[model samples]
Target: MARSTLLEVMGRHVQANHDTALQCWDGQNKEYIPVSYSLLSQRAFYFGERLVNTTKADQIQGQVIMIACHSPYATLVAFYGAISVGAIPMIFPMPLSLGSHEALTERIKHWGFAFGTPAMLVLEEGLNEKFHSEIPQDIEVIRLSDDPAASTETRSKSANDHQPKSDDIAFFQTTSSSTGDHKAVSISHSNIISNITGIRLAVDMADDERMASWLPLFHDMGLVGAVLFSFCNNYSLFITTPTQFVKRPSLWLKTMHEQQCTIATAPNFGFDYCSRLISEKDRDAMDLSHVKHLFIGAEPIRVSTIQSFLNKFSSCGIDAQVIRPAYGLAESTIITSISSHKKPSDFICVEADSIAIGESIRIVDTLAFSDADLSRYDPSKSVAVCTAGKAIDDMRIDIVDEDGNKIDAPGITGEIAIQGGSVAMGYVWGGEQLVEEFPDQYVRTGDIGVIHNDELYILERIKNIVIRNGENYLVSALEEQLAELLGISHEHIAVFESDIHDPSSDIVVLVERHAPIDEDQINQLLVAMPKEAFPINQILLSRAREIPRTTSGKKRHFYCRKLYQSGDMKFQQAIEVSPQRIMQAQALVNES
Candidate 1:
């Protein structure tokens, strides 16, 4: 029989056994604590019983139950508990830093009213206290305790009396808010199962495959790709928090080594951070030869970053072929396309000027091109794009022009559109289902990309394009060029148009500075920019971590631009080219 809903999958795993389902890292003890499938099921049922006894059945039957727990175990229990009761569960990250207390309270209140959220589950005492004191009485606040004894006494009718159908909503995922405000994407149980099935087949998942992840539970890649996928497939997983990984990158590797995990996933930044921060001593103590797949996605995949990571970790038994650059969005239930494990990621060099909408890209094939060849390409004239691989099973990808007509020619840049079983039903906001974003079962991804050799290649978000003087430039490409010229990580740089509507508006460049760079260096950087294609207009330098970023470490270019325009971003130094200099550059372009 085919499994339709998440509850069905959970039911299969509920049989009492000593087999480990999850190995949660204890950061304080520096060891992994195992959680069995039967124990997890029991705790989830107990939590569901408590929820059913306290809240009205009508309130939870199909409404949203918000979860903001820090622990992965607690969060999963809360998540499954909500599902057991037929309520939609939404996981959100708890506030990591001590910011404004009132602001946090207001934000919680806003979500409560907006989603008509009946209850909130939290584990942290400080968060529990804040909610009780400030949150409205209408919104019930439930504090989950980690103590085992607290849940042992519970035995009541399980909330499984009403079962959900395959098309029923499984959960809600929020956009990263990189381009705009956060919106909730409603994914169905069938959507999840279909995506999981596709990913399993695409990666050739095995019965003995063990997984490890440090990504937060709130993110789609962590929730769907790591947690739910493993749970549904009965794969053993090792889990930890993002904070732990950031504090000690070695923990992730050590856990992987000890557990002999075969699969792991992270954004491109994770590999870069590990390569840069992990000590040589720690690297020598670990072996990654057993790691079969390292799925990289959720942000732009930099070839340079991947090569650097491979070179740094090759001594630790890491293979260059394990790096899999993927492309996905929240609307697709986590994965759309992933590079195949059969070969290393493919790359191509293209003339930058030929990347305009509805135009065929001119491939620079005169040289034997590879990811390492990025340094050879002229930053302003060419770009090296990596393949995100073919669409997964039953998923169809098409590159469409502005008119929504499909672009038939390969290598022509257009908006990427998807049609697949995993496509989300629609978006929700303030407890109301918004109008359908996808019509005719096709989703316009709002991402710009191309098709080359029958494989998908991501370029940039439609919103990330900067138009000046009737020419368009990819902001990410420009940022990479600037980073290379300045000898810094591209992750620390942001480039966008100051006034998107004004063709002659200044091109704003924001750099997050880690070390001091003198004025002369900055001036040289400005002068070194390609005079014809790029005119150095304004540069702003802020302290490290000042630039706005999503939780997944992607630069929020639109948000940063708004901050710059409003004079809210705190910058240590600001440099602007005079109008005469700008005119001179423009004249130079005219002469060319």
Candidate 2:
């Protein structure tokens, strides 16, 4: 088998599609900047060669290079440039808001140790100083805008450069740790290509398809799936910053419409964000029916989100089926399973224990569930519905018991284990690849799930489950429920087990409210929740601007738990609260 290099695979396609090989949203111009394939590769080679020589006067092969850029263009240029020099580049997303320079420095310091001072950090403008003196002086810091490669000066290719192989590590993907740490998993070139191939096979990626995404370059879905996949497959990719999308979601719709984008992707919260925040007036002039593969992943799929987005955008000519529900992990390059062929998503509504049908959470109830009758399982209960679709190609998945034994039957809950070419090279630890033998084995996904007739359904991360009355419920599910009840978006609500052992109530639900805490709303929640769902001990009202989120935008509940315990969260509890938690909640509110 011939070795497949990143440049080798993408360079071939871009040779002809030079005109619109890459299209990035030019916010200043209120338009997109289309860079030709020839220009893109030209910059990659010129700067790549320069990077190889400037960083070190030796073989660049296998050297871990880091690229931190705010500009999507800068990140792309530096990434391919580093890769072109045969040095694996790990891309990190510039933090959205750093509040202070000290916070930024701390973040960089963490990353420096995470990868053990990569040979060089191709940092963005104004960010070079954050890493200065904090890390070893030997680790060179190259400002992206400074033109480390000096684009104008043609640099000669060195023999040490361009030695990429199939099995070589391509880049590192960041995975969030529970302890507020960030871990980067090594992804190989083969893993990326194989995963993209699986995406192509699973979704029937058409040659005529054009891609659009606002997901940050740091995440795999944005980097590999949208950005690099389109490049390698010879299609135009439309890129924008996540901040721009949040500020004006209408731009995303407009960009998609203008480019006639056939494929697009976002996390569940993103769709929910646009669905709620994007007013009907904002979408009056848009058309979205052209989209074929509107992928939703990077977070647990919510039935309400899919329905709400589809419902809200249906007026704009979007087919409800175009909104897909998909599942994946950073361990596997990007997407492993995505619904395709205009199929309506499959939603399984699991009966919520001690929940009655008349309850509030029952609004999401769908009839397709097998446990429809009260006899099969208690039907008089508020149920949580999750969209679980079929698996993609080139991937093998299994539901395993606690002991690592595979579950023989479908619908049995167990840990989700995945075996595929998409599986990353291994976890990077102490400047070395920890599991070199990882390729031959299944990456134990720490996610609890059930596979029914080959369809994968994620329940929750093993750590995020809250058990009450001997019945388990996911914190995400509670978040989803509280979002509906509170008339707020899902991402703003966080649920976690503050005290796991308490018999009466241990779970704490935190709501991100911009204004002062509403005592009436808090009282309403105390009255409505204890009967419909799990009993929440206390509701902590917080003003945390950036909900601690993973690169892919999944909420970090464990971190939030710590913030609550340490009293660091800008939380103002309602003056009046639950009887069991009134003393504590009121006391915290009194301090404010």
Candidate 3:
């Protein structure tokens, strides 16, 4: 019989596998420390035993247990431990260099309240003092440790007696608020297990597959795709924190090279960062020939970024087919669709002007260009959108109109809706919105996408669209064009409307300045932009890291718009372009 719950899966894996381990990178030592499955299971059981002894099983059962830890090992233990004793675990992001401490505290408080004040907060030992006073007094706090004694304790009977049903919520995944406020997505045990099974089949999982990841544990991609996927499959996983990867992008590649990891995952920015920061010498020393699949998701997939990454690492035996463009969200328990491993990624070039709501996109071309060729590609005329491939097993994807009616014809732009076993039960907080969004067992993804060649191609979130003068402009596409024109990373720029509800509102652009640029140079760059496509009224150059971002490195466009409206955004330089200035800039471009 098949396993019904996550606890059963964990028990079966531990009983069958003893050698497979979870390895964590030690940045200081520059090496990975391995923890065997046997030891990990023992520690988890011991932690669960402690929890059950302290609180009644009925009281903790179905209660939220929030985990905030820098160490993947601690997080894994705490996460499984909570589930072992029938508690629902939720991972929270720790403080990062780019994020503020006050912001994190406020977020934790807000989420805690939203989660009905979690029964407990599990934190890393080092962060106890920092977060102790900030946390509510009623919620018990537990500090994680790596004590060997934890593994020596006998498994508690009470912990083993409390088993969660398959339909019971196993964990709560917090959505990355790139467009709006965060909501807790309640994922059941069967939901995640079904997704894992789908992913395994989609990728054609092999017994020898080794995984490496540096994604944060709080994000759904990291928690479900990397950590739990590896654990449930009994695959050897080499893990590290996002801080380590950002500090040295080479380390992620180096670990993959050293371990001969076959499967890896990262966002679009990660691939971009690696391509830009990894030195030539490091690239020469790396051998990624063993890599079978490099899943890229969590943000908009840029064809240029992937092409540049492939070009930079081609000499290291990395094949172009290894790159897989994927699409997923917290609502789907991480993955809804992923590119097939048999062929190279597919992309479609469409006329930018033709992309709008409830309309069929005009196809410009169908091809995947190389990095050298893409450098000459004009973003003003067209945009190349990558296909996220077919839906996974037992999952159905459809394009729906604004009225929630299904659209049959392909290439028509509409909201993407997913119906599958992997879909979460509902949001913990937003019940009313959940009722509207989740209808007929299908979660209406706020993303705007289209069905082409029996595959899903995401364009942009509906919330990210800015309308002016009866024209809709995709913020992400505009950001990409502006970044290319200004010769900067798109991650450093954020473009959004001053008021999404007001069509006449000013279009504001915030660029994080990495180096000093004179006002004339900025003007020249602005002049080069396609005025008919995107007309900027306000531009601000802020200090590095001034623009707010979610923990997953996604720009909080809605939050940034709020900041701009409140006049709270800090900037070193500001430029307000009048209608006369735009006319003059257009005239200069025409004359040149």
Q: In candidate 3, residue 532 scores what lDDT?
A: 30
TM-score of each: 0.77, 0.74, 0.78
Assess candidate 3 and give its TM-score to the true structure: 0.78
Worst 10 residues of 1 by lDDT: 174-183
Candidate 2 lDDT for residue 291? 86
* Candidate 3: C-alpha lDDT: 0.75
Overall lDDT per candidate, in order of appearance: 0.72, 0.66, 0.75
lDDT of 2 by residue, 301-385 (tens): 6555666776788888886567667778778887767666655556666543312111222233344322233233333333344
* Alpha-carbon runs more than 4 Å astray in model 1: 1-3, 16-18, 97-106, 115-123, 126-132, 147-150, 153-157, 177-182, 365-371, 434-437, 464-592
Candidate 2, residue 68: lDDT: 67
Q: On residues 1-592, what C-alpha lDDT tens digit does candidate 1 reach at each position? A: 1348987777767653437768888777877788877767778777776677767436567666777777888888878788878777877655552123453455456556675445454444445564558777777677776433345654332565658889888887865412112357888898899888988889787888889998888789889989988887888899998889889888888888888998899876677788889999988998989898889887666666677788888887887677777888778898999878787776777775576668887888532213365667775566667779888887889999877899988889888999988888878666455324566558888777888878787765555656432123456666777777778898898887664423345878888875556755545555566432244477778886777776777786756756766677877777776556555645555564
Q: Please tell me which model should have the higher lDDT, number 1 or number 2.
A: 1
Per-residue lDDT of 397-474 in model 3, one digit per residue for the tens?
989986779999988988898998888887766322322234445798878788887878886565565544222355
